[model samples]
Every structure is written in structure tokens, then in C-alpha cells.
Target: MTHFRNDMENHDFFDTNIVCSIVIYEWANELSIIDFKHIFDWISQLVGTAPDSIQLAESEAKYKSYKWKYFEKNNVINRREWDLIAYHWFRNIETKSGIRVYCVASTRSFRRLGIYIDEAAVVDVIGVMKQISRTIIEKVEPIYGYGAMQSYLDGPLEYARGINVTTYYSHENIFSQADVDTRERISAFGSEFRKNKRRLNEKLRDVEVINYISAGHLAGIVDGMTLEDWIISGNRGTLNKEGEATWVWRIPDEHERSQIRTDLIRSGLLVVTI
Candidate 1:
């Protein structure tokens, strides 16, 4: 009853959870492992423009595999169909049609889509389809959790939001069990770490720096600082506003860049990058 349903009206779709429910489950073993390659093939066959977009998405999440088959089965409308249905559910036929750009394009060329991001849309038509009433086909997995994105702090968490979305994938504030583990580990280490530095200090003997860096290697040295101070700063000091653990401290010119790096090695703060 998903894509084939009749209250069809201007006929299109809807959704609340992310397309693939991969990130919702806290445990890796809970999901059915499926190859993204098959999804890519299906998308490619259907639209001819998904190769680039899919490849980009895949590369972005290289740390873990991208699974699509389970999502296909859940919606009964194929992933592409689901996207159209979900967007339709979110916006009306008139409103969705007026839009020129979307994260997921419908066609492979501009001729088939409205305009904006430059690349041909691969999902334009699918998103605007109006001929089918939507249904879940089957029940979504009973064990599901919500992942909140923002400002939900004042209210109940996502899981308590009372929406039909039993699972959330890409949003923030959704803490999976793995997240809990990492948080617990950090918590366990917190008290000891806050007790004040015992051996790590301003003394010059402990820090290390390096030279001959690769492009964007984020390793460099500052002037007049002992290696120990460098280590202290890098390990437990002001790491800019973003908390980027790796960085190259500012040096004025190429010569200064070279000199400070050498000085750091001489000062002896451990210098290793890889």
C-alpha cells in the first residue's frame, strides 16, 4: 500500500526518519548488512546521474559501510521512490514544484530539472509524482529510537517526541550505545585528568616538534617556546575555538616556519606525525 495506495490526491510521498535507518540502532549487529553497490546500481539504472552523488556520499562516510537494502524493504517504494514520497509528504505538489533546488536532484540533466546547484538533478521527477497514496507496506521495526538535532534540550529527548519516526539517522543529539560507551570512558578518565598536571609542565625536556611536513600536515612550531611547553599546549592547552587536536601554530614566513620546527626538535618535545 506504500507507493500504490489511493487516497493518492496529487499523488506523492512523505517521511520523518532519515532514508536509511543505519545510524539509529546503537549496536552494529542489529542491522542487516547490505552492499551500497547494489543501491548504486539501482539508482544508476533508474536515473543515470547517481554515480557521482552516491560516490560522494560513500566517500563522506568511509569509516563505515553504507547500507541501503534494508531501507528499500522498509519503505516498499525503493529508495528513490521513498525520497520522492518523503519530500512530497513534507511539501505540497505546488510548493515542491516551484522549488528549483534540492539536496537530491531528480534527473540527470538540467533539461529535466529546475535549476540551482548546476549538476543535473537525478530525482526531480520522482519527487513530484502524484498518483499514489502512501502506506508503510509493513510495520517499521518496533525497536526504534529518535535522534534529535537541536534545541530539544528544554524538552524531552527525541525518543520521547511521539512522532511516527521510530528511528533517526543523520541528526544530532541522538546518542547510540557506542556514543554512551565513549562518553562513559571519557567520564571515567575525567577526575584523574582534572587532578592537575603532575609531570607535564613548562620544563623544556619533554615536548617534540617536526619538520619536512606534507601539504596540510598541521605540524609546525612557534618561536621562543621549549618543547615541553609546546607539548603542554598541544595536549592540554588552548586548541583554538574549535578543539582541533592537530594544527600548525602561526609563524610569519617560510624561513620562520623552517627555523621553529628545527628549534622544536632541538628542544625535544616528541615530534611524530602520521
Candidate 2:
């Protein structure tokens, strides 16, 4: 069995502890497409793991051929070689090493490449990201590129249920119980943030507000801090990855959670209505 890191430093968000170390990139075009072979090589060197199963686009179940060595035999499963030629894209990849990669094609109008790293190998997550970044053909601005530690909760916004807190921005990345139509969508490079600056300043006047876009590790954004460094700074229970996920996470003491929340708010990272 994989023994995940339990030390205080890793206690923040290691895999299967109900906590996940995740980095997501949403590209406007197909220019940022990742080279899966590069990723496989990196993971193999990083943690000695390789892809074992793949979930094709629109497929209901993951397909795995024990006869074929996914890593050695074929660097990556091209759509044409696979029996399912109708599916021309990769939806998700499940690796024996406990890391999962999600790639949504541009045909959906929203292309994204998301990597969920195992907590044990969380230290070099940015390395995995940098590997993907090497594929960028042109200097393209991302719709959203951020890393975050997500916890699997019982329900949407379960931590703040019943609280009359107002949410400023949300998207498919955030988990919320509010009606979908009521939630607001803010662009990464838009003037909406500037326009609402005064309102945010007044509401969180004394509080340091950290945007979700900088939640984890983003190249040119972390300010020389590594993913581990960011995780050590504070806890982020405000963000969640999956609601019905069966994974279990270690629930820190209330005082610890409160302190983390307070620290993040002070750093302008998290904002709550109390």
C-alpha cells in the first residue's frame, strides 16, 4: 500500500487523505496541448509510476489492456490505434502511481489540461507543470492557470452551509451550493476585478484578500515559493474538488482550521462573511 506523507509539512494536502494537490490550466486554443510522453517520462523519473488506464472522450468506463505496456510498448495511445476511433480525444488518464490527468479537447470550446498529483510526490508538481509548459508554441494567455489543494467534502460548500455569505466569483472550478444562474463568472484578464475593487476593499477592508487564481503554484506567480512552500503557509478548506468523492481527508482541529482560514484571509487569500 502507498504510505502517504503524514508529517506536518505534508499533512496539509497529500493524496487519498481526502486532500488533493491539483494544478489546472485552461487554454484559449490548442497551442498549449501537453505531450503525454513527456509527462509519462517525468512521472516515471519523479516517482517510478506510469499510466495504466485511460478514459477516452465520451466513454463511460476506463479502458486498460494488460497485454499492452502502456508506457513501454506505446508512448501514448493515439486515437487511431485504439479500437475506439470514434473518440478522438483523451478525457482522463489513471496512472498506477496514483496521479490522474484530465485533458478536455478544444472542440468543447473550453480546452483544459489538469493534473492531480499524488501527495507523496507533491514536491515537484510545478515540475510536471513546467514540462507541460514546454509544449506551448506561442506565448498564449491562459483563461485560468492555478494550483490548489482541494478537499473532498460531503456536500457543496459544506464548510459554510447555512451561512449567508456572498460569493464574488465562481466557475466550474469552484464548488458552491448557490444556484448556478446566480453565481458570477469573472475573467482572468478582465476589468471586472478592477471595477469591483472598491466594493471588495470595503467588504474586506482590513482583510488581505487572496484570489483563487493564485491559490497554489503558478509559474511566474508564486514569487519564488514552491508548491510545498505555499502549502506550508496555510490551509485552504474553502476550496473543494469533488462533493461526492469517496476519498477521506484528515479533518484538522477546529482551532487549526480557523487559524489557517484567518492566516489566508490576512494574506488576502480567503474571504468569508463570518
Top TM-score model:
2
Please give the CA lDDT of all the candidate structures.
Answer: 0.24, 0.31
Error of 1 at 183 (Å): 40
- After superposing all C-alphas onto the true structure, candidate 2 shows an RMSD in angstroms of 13.8
> Candidate 1: which stretches are off by over 4 Å?
1-248, 270-274
Tens digits of per-residue lDDT, candidate 1, 136-206, equal 00111211111111112111121121112223342344632324432333333233223432111111111
Q: What is the lDDT for 259 in model 2?
A: 58
Off by over 4 Å in 2: 1-18, 28-37, 58-76, 81-110, 120-143, 153-274
